[model samples]
Target: MKWMPFSFICLLALGGCQAVPSSLPYADPPPSQACYFPSAASSTLTASVDVLTEWGFSLDASDTRLGLLSASRERELHGASDLYASPHFSSRTSLSVFGGMGIGGRSHLGVGLGGGFGQLPIEVERVSLLWDNHHVRVSRDIRRFDQYGSLRTGRSASTDDFCARFQRALDANTATGDSPS
Candidate 1:
């Protein structure tokens, strides 16, 4: 016999379960829930981008312009709503809060998270993109080994030099904006 009762129960179980949506819709993430950003996100993220650029990426002056464009778009996507909600969002843009949208803020926040943890004091994502997706410092020893290998092969600069160069790039960016991005 085919265990009809068991099959019937299985069928009911399968049919009764609701499909999980691919994404949870934003119904105003509960007001009680505050944003908990991690502390190392900025430094770690800055370090990562600095490293990427130090290795091979070409982050020229035009790259800065692109960063401005991207940061504009990013703000539009992630923090647009937050920005638009505030008339004092910047020293300029006196009445920009009226231009609010939700996507920009979300994009900015998501990108920011990728560089490190989440508690970065500056805009690490924008900095990374502007720096051509490299970082200045590295936490893992193997990464240093990778750089050393490149040097051994005569295809890379010294690790300390790379870090210093990356540091300069990051510093340049930090000085440009009102906030250290």
Candidate 2:
């Protein structure tokens, strides 16, 4: 029959519309680093606070008894100047008006207005340290926020390089006999 060829073509087209998988491969967590110290937990925590402060992070909270220390640092990814330079920073205005007569001779009018403003992004990095008498574990987290202070994205378990650097700093601090008050 003449319709057989057309049916075959339609089947071929439908078969070509297979759905492609959009799933992404799983990502492994970043490596963690631990530093060992010979000093008391309190002393190690104090030195950690000092090092973190030097790195621009302010101590948020700590409990030497529990060997827990938390610090955070915030920096603006876009400054005021950058915000001013953005295209969205310029003042804009939009208006639309429409008038129509219906079948019953009724008149209708509609108007729409819209505007937007630009906002900068801020980055905040946080670090946490836990330690015993001679062992310390450090972890870092990073988050991004909009100018309105709403978090956009965040990640935990930063790379090992940061912990390594902290370890070196702690080593130098202890080696120099910097007593913790």
Candidate 3:
């Protein structure tokens, strides 16, 4: 009859277990920005490249005929000090030293160290510009990578600030007949 308690406890534990919900919805994508200019697509593309370069993005691909441009920028997101302050490093170290004296004495000393040259967080921002005739649309995608080079998080959006800056720059360049520098 003593075993009945153990069986009931096991059953209770099993009943408490729940399957992870797999139907969780993902977040919505960020909004894109579009602007219209009276200038031709080719000129707009050239000016866009110049402005993007000023923003620290390197042109990855461009097709003037198709009015498409792609650029990306990468930057480090964290340093060694940030890594050391993270829980991934702080909570993993363990040290144990035990000594006992008796007929059956046992002495044990152990050191468990965790953490390595990992934990480099990087942020990559990619921008896509598409233009046709006098209308230009710009979208940005941002992704954060963990130390292992795996994507930690990502979002796609074109903020108003970016669109405003791009429009202002393009207007100035196109109006002044200033070629991309």
Off by over 4 Å in 1: 1-136, 139-158, 178-181
**Model 2 residue 52 lDDT score:** 88
TM-score of every candidate: 0.19, 0.60, 0.61
Residue range 34-111, candidate 3, lDDT tens digits? 433345544787778888898899999998778899999999776533542445443223433334444436755554
> Model 2, residue 175: displacement in angstroms?
1.5
Candidate lDDT (C-alpha), each: 0.32, 0.69, 0.71
How many clashing residue pairs, candidate 1?
A: 28
Sort by TM-score, best first: what order?
3, 2, 1
Q: What is candidate 1's lDDT per residue for 81-114, written digit by digit as tens? A: 3322323333222332323335654542221111
* Shift in Å, residue 3, candidate 3: 36
Candidate 2 per-residue lDDT, tens place, 1-181, comes to 9999999999999999998889975324654644333444346766777788888999899987788999999887755333433243332232333345445566655454434334467888988887887677777888887555667777875566777778888877765656456
Better of 1 and 2 by lDDT: 2
**Candidate number achieving the greatest lDDT relative to the actual structure:** 3
Colliding residue pairs in candidate 2: none
